[model samples]
Each structure stands twice: as structure tokens, then as C-alpha cells.
Target chain A: MKRSFYLKIFLFVVLLFSSALADAAEVYYLGGPQGSSQEAAVNPSYSLKQRFQDLFSSLSSIRKDPEASGSISGHLSQTVVHNDIGGNREKSYLKPGVNYITDLNFSIQEKLHADYNFTGQWFLRKTDDPRVESRRDVRLKQVDLQVANERNLYQFGDFYGSFSQFVLGSSLEGFNMDINPTDDQHYQIVIARRNEADTVANSFQRNVFGFKADRYLFKGSDLFSDFRIGVQAASSQDDSASLPDNHTAKDLRNTVFGLDGEIVFKQGLSIQYEYAGSAYVEDEDASEKTTTYANAFRFQPSMRLGKANVRYLYYYAQPKFYTDAGSSMSDKIQNQVSLDYRFSDRVNVTVSENYYWDHLKGSSRTKRTFNDEKYMTWNLLPLASRRSFNLRPYVNYQVRNSDDPGNSAESTTLTGGFDISDRLNAHTNWGVGYECRSFIDRVTRSNSEIFHRIRFNWAQDMMLWARRLYYAITPNVDIRHRKGNDNKDVTVGAGFNVQYDLFQRVFLRMGNTLADTNSASPSGDYVNNRGFWEVDFLVDKERSAHFIIRGERNNYTAENGAQSYKEQRVIAKFEVNF
Target chain B: MRTKTIIAVLLTSMIVVGCRAVTGAVVDRRAVAQESLFSLAGTLIKDLFDNYQDFSMESFRAKVAVDFVSSRNDLVNNAASNIRAAKVLDIDFSLDQVLSDKDLLMVDLKWQKRTRPYDSSNVVLTEGFTQAVFKNVAGQWLLYQINKDNPF
Candidate 1:
């Protein structure tokens, strides 16, 4: 009797909440790395991310004017993660990290054309334990400030609107140094629970200050056109201190200056130019200088045809003295041209080409003793062709010239893809490239590769009372051939991911991938299999408050050996934006 | 489960058939309207560029400046919106007739337009445009393709 009564109450509450959601606006939330989202095994689920925005806006409106309405919003996201790998080695870790961001924003404007706006945000972050390397704890804190003054102007020839004709800004940021991920030698990546005494921790403090100014030259449509120019200056200070009180490092100072300008020609030819430079200073033994610059020009003769773009740039950097003694001074020049063509609604193509020439002058010690100086003389140029069909199918090809030393001897790559029917898609690519003459003699290598992929996708928004599921099957094969070597390898892989949205704000996802490779070995033949698994669960109360738990496991097995690794992480986030 | 699958397919087919009927009519209208717009915009641009001597930088600037001042006044008085000025102010210099076959028309347009600076006191122009296609639909003109470089 008690269980039945509880069940009845739950059903009633669910019905009431769902009815409320049916009347709210719909907004989809897409969160992923690198500004793009991946397809899931289940259909795309729509979340009420938009409803939150509408709710906030309405709340602000209700409290407007008489109340001078405003809202302070923030988000706190923290993750606890663990990783495990075994080989008779017992290792454990409890790494914890938290990122909290808060912003204060408000606006007050009168009937006048001028207004003042201010926005500020604070970001605080801390990492307690690092996995790849031994580290105790690190923290970073930063603050941003933005203020602008805008006014209505009738001086610009044909433009209409109020502009921020002038502005001023400054900021301060600092963080504790941690591990470097780009390039770490084998000696730096060791993590052993049994050897805690040999581990060391080091950290650094950094700060930066900056300022900027902008101004307009004239207004109105004239043969001379409208113009604007901006200038900025910034500087940073770095101080490092290692553990065990070994030594106190000198402060490193860096300064940068920049300038930018834009011009509109009466003939519709618009040109823009910008330049920036930086200088670094440290102890007499470890100081260096560097600079970078770029220029671009575009033209459109009429409205029907597209624009033609041309760009050129040069960059030079001199090697440092202490740690980079035998290094060389490097210089690089690049040129590019592109044209956009629109044939019709269903067809379009863009043609582009890029050429680069680089030179390195060996240092005195390297010039006399090292053979690298002879290898420094080289150039590289690549020609690219691209075409798009019906906005859904596309093809691209690239050819390279290799006589320039740094370039491949002769190489060509082609990729073509199409959507077959509504549920199937396929892509294929192949490339053949040769090693430069210099490397050909030593490595004696030429390479050929072929890749093919096909995927089938099916999704529906409505299924079994608002529940949605999306699924896809992707299979790919890659074949590689090498010269001077009788052995070759072919690899085939497939992956699938799916999300099942249950009720209003609860969901679960599961994904897996498998890869198999067949290789002709020096002794005979070999096969390797690699697979991975992923699972995640999430819940949101109001779209602004959320909780997520995710885990991944990967395994690799071969005829001779096998290895398995796993990771688990959980994150809780909440925010309210106005 | 098999019955459910059949029902789902039947429902989707019904919806698709309904959509197709409506789309068929729209396609015909769009085809004609797009053709007409393309022809008019293309021809105008080509004629302007062909007589570039009459529309030199000095003359063009003078005309735009005068027109801008008047438009600004009208906007302040709430008599007009910025769109009116934008339409009258669009100027293209690179004009080439690339397609005039069949009943459809296509042309490439490359032109530069000066924009009002954030301060409104200064003007900066950027040069850009597109090759556009037009089709006449239901006695109305519509645009199909618009790009900076020549498409066809």
C-alpha cells in the first residue's frame, strides 16, 4: 500500500512538470571541445537551453526602470578524475580541479546619443594533483575589465548607427606554472608511488598589463572613404622559484607595441594594415629579441562576382644565446592567393594556392662543425584545388613541389565525399609522397596511402513520448605502403556513440570503438586489436544547474602482449545568466 | 514491434507527400522570381562599371555624401529606417556579364562600400561583392546566388 501511494504521487508530479515544459521556449545546448560537436549513436536531443534565456530576459524586464534591474551570474565547475595502468606496478592518484567564473554586467543609458557600459569577470582555478608528472598543487586567478563610450555620428558618408568611436581598457592575469604538455622527454614523465623521494615540484608566477586607444579620421561617403586607426601597448613579468631553496631566478620582462588602421576607397577597394612588435629582457646571459608582422588585401569589382584575396607575410626569429647556442637564426616568407566562385545555388568552388620559403643561418659553432647548414637551403610550394557539389558533396586535391628541400619530392592527395541517399554517406582519399633527396639516401623511404570511410546515420526527434535516440555506424580502412621495406600494414576501425534522453533533464550516453590492424612482419604476419568504451550520465534541473559523470576504458591486445587502461571523471556545474 | 515500424513509415510518408505538394508550387515561383532579380542587378552593375569615367571617385563620393546627410536627417525624424539608405547607397564597380542564357540571368559583381565608423564621425569602406544569379518567379524577381568572385 505504501509503495503504490508513493508511485501515484511521483506520476502526478511528473505530469505537472512536463505540462509546464510544453509551454516553455525550446533551446538546444551543444557543448564540446574545439567549437564543434560530434554525432551520437542516438538522435540529437534538444534541451531547453533557450527557455532559460527567455526566462532571464522576462525577469529583467519585470524589474526594469523603477528598479534599475540587474543580475549577477556565475558558474562553478569542478572535476575529480582518476587513471589506472598496471604492470605489477601499484599506482594510485586523487587529482582534483575546480574552475569558477563570475561576471558582473549592467547598462544605463539616457535619451542622449552617448552611453557608458561596463563589464567585469573573475576566473579562479586550482589543480591539486597532476597525473602525467609529479605535482602538488597549482592555482591561477585572472580579472577582466571593459568600458566604452559610444555616440551617434552623422559625419560618416552613408553609414547609420551609434559607434564606440573611442574606448579604453586594461587587465591583470597571473597563474602558477605547471607541467608542459607539448614536448616532455622520457625522464620527465615517470610517476612511481615507490619513488616519492626523487620527485620534485616547481612553480612560477606571471603578470601582464595592457592598454589601447582608437580614433576615427572622417565621416561620409567621399572619394577618400571613412577611416579608423587603433594602437595598443602591453607588458608581462615572469618570476620563477624552484623547490628546496636552490636559487632565486631573475625576473623576465616582455613588452609589446601594436598599430592598426583601415581605409575605404571610393572605388570600393578597401585596404587594411596592422603591425606589432615585442621585446624581451632578462639577465645578461639569457636575453633575446623577436618580431612578427602580416599584411592582407582583398578586392571585389562588382556585386555579381566574388572577391579576390592576396596576402603576403615574413617572419624572422633569432636563436637565444644560453640554451640555444648551436641553434640557427630562422626566416620564413609566405604568399597566398584565393578566389571564391558561386556558380549557382547547388554548386560552388574555392581555388587557393600557398607558397613558403624558409632559410636558417647556422650559428658559428654549427656552421663549422655541423652538416645541418647544407640542409637549411630549401623551399616548399603546394597547389590546392577544391570543389563543392550541391552543398552536400565535395572534393579536394593538393599537389606539392619537392625540389626545395623541406618539401616532399613529389606528392599528390585527393579526397572526395558524398551523401548517398538520406541515410548513407561515404568518403575516400589517397596520397603518394616521396622523401627529399637528402633524406632519401639515409631513410630510403617512399610512401603510399589509401583511406576509405562510410557511415550510415538515422535520427528522429520524436519517439515514444518525447524520448529521442540517434544512431550511426562508421567504418574506415587505411592502407600504407613503404619503400625499401617489404612489410605493409592495413588498419580497419569502426565507432558508434548514442545518447538516450529519458525525462525532462536526465540523460545517459554510451559509445565504443574498435580497430584492427594486419601487418606483414619481417618474420611472418601479425594482427593487433584496439578497443575503447565510454559511458556518461547527466541531469539538469533548470538547464542552468547540471551534474555529469563520465568514464572511459581503452584496451590494446596483440599476438605477443596486451594492455588495458581506464579513466573516470565527474563534474558538477551551475550558472544563471542575464 | 513490426506493426509500430509500419505505422511510423506510413506517418512519415504522409508528411513527405504533403510537403512535396507545397514545395512543387514554391519551386516554380522561386525559379521565375530569382531569374528576374539576377538580370536587373547584373545589368545595373555592368552598366555602371562600363561608364566608370562618369562615376569617378570624386563624383561618387560627392553624391554619396549628399545623400547620406539627407538620410541621416530623415532617420532622426523617424521618417525612414536605415534599410532605405542601404539600398540606395549600394555601389558596385566590378561588373561582368557571365551568363545570360535561357530565361535565367547571372552576373558577377565586385564593389566596395564605405561604412560609418563606430563614432559615426569617420567612414571606412571595405571592397567586396559577389557573383549572383537571379530567377523570375510569379512575375517577381528573386536572387539565387551571391558571391564575391564569379561563380559561373
Candidate 2:
């Protein structure tokens, strides 16, 4: 063994010397070096400097070439976690076990020929745990690629496509293209899977296709600063056969078309409108599948005048309207208006009202409900000195009325709150808030209730032993009273946190919260405590290490018995970026 | 002589009017450019809020960076719960400040929102100022980070 080791050492030395000799030859061929050719040949120190200079110059030359330049940046993280639970294991949110997780993410960008650029992103995650399925233990979360120029872009693998709110808006694993044919024309096309495939369960998948186009008019006109009109269409179908079982598949088929327009004037007025129509089939494979047709529209206008701003919105959707990729509420009509004004540099006010109704088709079994909401807020400095303190006060009220022949009902809610804060010094500050709320039910008096809540907080930053230390303390209380039984409930909570710079490169943070509640009902009574401490070490600009410990305990006293649980977890993580 | 004087006056008037017209056109062009940029930023921000309000995770994910980090730990779980628990009723915002770098845009704005929690009957009003950073990737601005508080 000794002989072999010595032989290896000798071979390594010989190889190293050979490489150095080759480098010296290259320097000689480059005219003996830069800045001092004679000295570089005679003096070893000067020759070393010249070699480094040459190396840097070549590297810089590579960087200067735009087409040859590329960047690779990424981060790697490894984490180990442990969790423990005691008392009523069924009530615990997480399993008791040890887990090891590794995450890797990176991005690459390169400039190609013909003024085109290429970008690629990749993400990978792995976790080891007995309860986790093997297929899920290791996963490729995302992989995306793109090639783009000034006016056009092409993407594949995984991309996010958004054409319009009511037509097509979602992320998909697909191919997408965006083309700007002229300064005033734009178009987009997308074809992709709407949902990720579940190979383990053999779940169904949705396939979607979308197209959109827009044209701009009066771009630079003083009367109409920006005017644009657009049209979008989308279609999706669920593959029932994709899932072997097919029991949970919806087998849905949907198609939507939309038209939208927007106009902005130089005089600080803007208006936007959109209309959409949809055809949907809930169960495509069923024997008597029925198709539904519905429509929806939205109109919004806003204006700015002097120190005031006003906005209005109107929205309506038919009962059967449905779009999986967009936000649409069916059988509804809504109208909203708001105004904001600035009285001075130190004071501002805003008021808004919203009215909405549901069950527009008036189905016999479904109750039609109307909701009205009003809100007002004020921001004020209150004090004569603008820097002394700040105050914000707000009020909100809402009413709901339901009509159902003989079972009509109405409810109202009012909430008022104020928040006050002040800075005592450069390193200390404090804030306090109070809120009162009341809910009244005309038909069901038993459901009426009132709530009062108060909160206080203080924060301080100090220099202790020439290091920075910061801490905050918060305490709050909430009380509730029910009208029918005169029952009362109360909850008190407190939280404290401290952060200190333990060393030049190390940071320490610890925080805990405690809450106790006493309610009329046994199920609502509980004591909860949670605490956590974390330490972070900055190894360098591109590397970091973190250690975190967390614990939680909850004690519940119910009518039947006491259900309690305690959990503790520890995690250690190291991350590096390149 | 009188005819020559009249001709000189007409020439001077034309020169002054032409200069004014050119100056006006230049100013208008600059204003239009500025307005377009602001409009673009405004639309992006509005779209983000709409997605948040709708609780569309896929659409929201597309607007943010892949390696997005937050000051609050467990950003993924917290974001999910926050979205599920709150129903946004109304939102108002003003984009008064925007700073541009090579591929990054930083926006500072004041905003107000009215929201109702799933378990609560009362609507809560909140107002604050926040700063958001967006990076241009393939001609699209993706949210990089937020300072102060995250609304979504």
C-alpha cells in the first residue's frame, strides 16, 4: 500500500509540472508576455503576472461578444426535517417522521443569431419519507424553454397563457406563440394541457386551445390617447379515457368566445368593456348529455378630476355561464361605485358602495338574495406636527335580503375600526387598534352577535454590545356576545419576537405566541401555544445555512372529553447559489 | 418700402408660429410615450390583483418568478391559506412612483382593499404602501419580490 501511494504522488507531481510547462510555452509564443517582454522571460514573478493578465483579457473578450455571451445561475438547497406529535395523534396536522428534502433550480439565457434569444428554466425536488409515494418522492416541478425576438416569441414545454379574463386565463403545459405583426396589431395562440397528468392515480386530463387578437386605434390622438379592441376564443375537453377508473372524471366540454374594448383619454378618463358567451357540457359521455348556453358582460369606467377620483363598475352573468379558466359568477348582477378625495397633504378620504343580486333566473327551489355594502375610510395625521403620529379610521356596513315566498329573511352587519401609530424615536415605535362589529339577523334572532377586538404592539431596535438587536411585543383581546342566550365568549393572545445579530455572519430570531379562549360552548374553549427559533449563518454572498425549530401545543376541552395535541419540528437547511 | 416691411412681419410671424408648433409636437410625443409606459404597468398590476381575487393559482404562478422568496417563511402554504380564507370585495390603488433599470422596474404605490374572511361576517378595510419589483423576461414583466407587505 505504501509503495502504491508513493507512486501515485510521484505521478501527480509529474503531471502538474507538465501542465505548467505547457502554459509557459504558450506564454513564450505570445511574444514573451505583455508589458515587459524581457522581464517576463527572465523574471518568474513578472511572467506569472503576465499569464494572469492574458487569461483575464481572453475572458473579457469572450464577455464582450454579445452573441457568444451566456449566463447560468442557479441555487441548490438540502434540508432535513423532523416532526413529533403527542396526545391525540389523530388531531395532529402533520405525520410524525423524519424527512429529507432536496431542491434544485436553475436558469440559462443565451443570445443567438439573428437577434433572437433563448431562455431555459428547470426545477427539481426530491423528498424521502415512508408515507410518501415513490412516484411523488422525486419530481420535476417545472421545465420551460423560450425563443424570442423583438416582435415575436415562441415557447414550449411549460408556459403561462393569459388572453382575457372571461375567455382564457391559466397556466398550462403547452406550446404558445405571441406575434406583433405591426405597431398596432397583436395576436396569440396556445395549445396545451390544462392540468398536470396524474400517472399514479391515472387521473383524467383536460386539453385546451385558445386564440386571441387585438388591434389598436387612435394611439397618439389627443382626444383618444389609447383605443384598443380585442377578440378571444377558447375550447377545452376532458379526456375520460385518460383515467383507467374514470369514476372521478367530469368529462366536461366547454367553448367560450369574448370581445373586449378599452379607451383611455388624455383628460384622465378611461372605460373598459367585455362580453363573453359560452357553451358547456357537464358530462360528455353520459347518455343524455345536454349542452348549456350562457353569456356574461362587464363595463367599467374611471375618471380623475382635480383632487378626486371616481370609478364605476357594472357586471352581469347568466345562470348557466361557466368557464373553468376564468373568474365568472353565474346568476349574478353587480353594480359598484367609489370615490376618493384628498383634502390636503395630511388627510384623505374614500367612500364606496356596492350592490349585487344573485339567482337572476329565479329558480323555484333557490332563494334570490340581494346584498348592499358601503365602506368609508379616512387617513389623517390628526396632530398639528405632521411627523408626530398617524391615524386611520374606517367603517363598513353590509345588508343581505333574501326572498323565498314564505321564508323571507334579512341580515345586516356593521363594522368600525381605527388604527393609531406613533414613532417615539429613531429606534422605537408603537401602535394600537380597536374594532367593533355587530351582526343583526331579523329572521333569526339567535344568530345575532356583537364582537369587540383590541390590539397593541410595540417594537424596539437597540445596539447591544455593538450588535443590532430588534424585538417586538403584541397583545390582543377579543370578546363576543350572542343576543339570544346572553352568552359571552372571550379570547386573549400575546406574541413576542426578538432578533439579534449573534455574530458577524450569524443571525438569531425567536418568537412565540400564546392564546387562551373561554367560550359559552365547550368546543370553542382551547389553549394554544406556538413557538419557533431560527438561526441563519451567512457563509458567503452565495451560500447560506439555516436551522429552525418549532413547537405547538393545543388543549381543547369539549363536552365529551379533552382532546389535546403537541407537535415539535426541527429543520436544517443549506443553500448555495451560482 | 411699406410692402417690404409688411413682408418681413409676415416672415417673422411664420417663424415664431412654426417653432411653437414643433415644440408642442415634441412635448405631445413625450407625454404619449410616458402615458403608454404607465398604462402598461398599471394593466400588469391590475391583472395580478384580479388573479389573486379569483384565487386562480395557475394564473398567479405564471406572473411570479420560479424561485420567488418572501420575508415570511412558508410562503407557499401561507399564500394558499390566505387566498382561501379571504374574499376581496374591492380594491383601489395609485401607482405614483416607478423606477426603471435595465431589466427591472420598481414600483411604489398606496392601496386600499376591503375584504371579508370566510368565517367572519364583517368586512375589514386595510390600507398601506408597498413596493414591488418586476423583472422583464422575454418581454413580459414577472414579479420578483415585494417589500413591506404582500397583499395576496
Candidate that would win on lDDT: 2
Worst-scoring 10-residue span by lDDT in model 2 chain A? A34-43
Among all candidates shown, the one with the greatest DockQ:
2
lDDT of 1 by residue, A1-578 (tens): 53464345435433432322222211111121111122222112223564344335544442333212222333345454444433211111222343222222222211111122232334344444332112333332323232211111111111001111111011112211111111110000111111011112222344443333334444454764656554443444554431234534444555444444566666655555544444556532245533222221222122123433332222233222110000112232333343445454434444434444333343232221111110010111111232221123333343434334444334544444443333122332222211111112222234443333333333333355668765444554544444545654444555566666765567666766665555433322222222333333334334343455556453433332322223233433333322
Candidate 2 stretches with Cα past 4 Å from truth are: A1-68, A129-136, A196-203, A245-248, A362-365, A406-409, A543-561, B1-152
lDDT of each residue in A1-578, candidate 2, tens digit only: 53464345434433433333343334435532212212211111224454444434433332323223354555577877788887666554357888887766666655444345566767666877433224445677656677655445667865555666678655567887675433455567788997755666544688988876677777568799888887777888887877766376568899887878899999999998888888899989788999888889988899999999998888888888888665466787888888999999889998878788878773333788888878787889988764659888878787889877654659887777788889999999998877777778888887777777677889999999999999999888767777865556666778899999999888888887776666555354555576778887777643333444333333332222335566677877787655
Work out how many backbone clashes candidate 2 has: 0
lDDT values, one for every candidate = 0.32, 0.64
Proportion of native contacts kept per candidate: 0.00, 0.00
lDDT for residue A60 in candidate 2, whole number 0-100: 31
Model 1 docking tier (incorrect/acceptable/medium/high): incorrect
> Which regions of candidate 1 fall more than 4 Å away from where they truly are?
A1-70, A78-120, A125-141, A145-212, A224-226, A231-258, A275-330, A360-443, A447-462, A485-487, A520-540, A549-551, A562-578, B1-152
Every candidate's TM-score, chain A alone: 0.54, 0.84
Candidate 1 second chain TM: 0.37
